[model samples]
Target: MAELYSKARTKWACRRGMLELDILLEPFVDEAYDQLSEQDKLVFQRLLEVEDPDLFAWFMGHEACPYPELDAMVKFVLDRVRA
Candidate 1:
């Protein structure tokens, strides 16, 4: 029950208002989030706290995420989606 709730909350957080962010984040949360380590999962949650525009820029390659941990996680998510 707790795990399900956590996943549900995470999924909810993944839903940014922008369609592009929704497409990338929703599917990644569904498919890949479960595979993450606990620390990595925390990083993902932190990523969700980032503003949509920054996330869009990071995901679209318009700008690099300045934080290394978040940047690495962004690349990891992108690579998984690409694969």
Candidate 2:
């Protein structure tokens, strides 16, 4: 499947206004995004569309993501970095 966004564009989108989000997302795009399956990449992109506050909350374990696909992708990103 063709990518929905270029790596450069995706990396740019990963740059949130919050530093903590920027720290988590930018490196994930650089380090692990290329290794993801096409479907998973799409999921990640969808996750990026969510608001920064929501992303921050989910990543910080303060709130659960309501969407299952997004939640899974969030967990995947968190697990990858935590590992």
Q: What is residue 70's positional error in candidate 1, in angstroms?
A: 0.1
Query: Residue 42 deviation, candidate 2, in Å?
Result: 0.6
lDDT of 1 by residue, 1-83 (tens): 34633778999988788999889988898899889988888888889999999999999999999999999999999998888
Candidate 1 ranges with C-alpha deviation above 4 Å: 1-5
> Candidate 1, residue 46: CA error in Å?
0.4
Candidate 1 lands at a TM-score of 0.92
**Over the stretch 9-60, how does candidate 2's per-residue lDDT look in tens digits?**
8999998899999999988998999999888889998999999999999999
Clashing pairs in 2: none
TM-score of each: 0.92, 0.93
For candidate 1, list the clashing residue pairs, or say none.
none
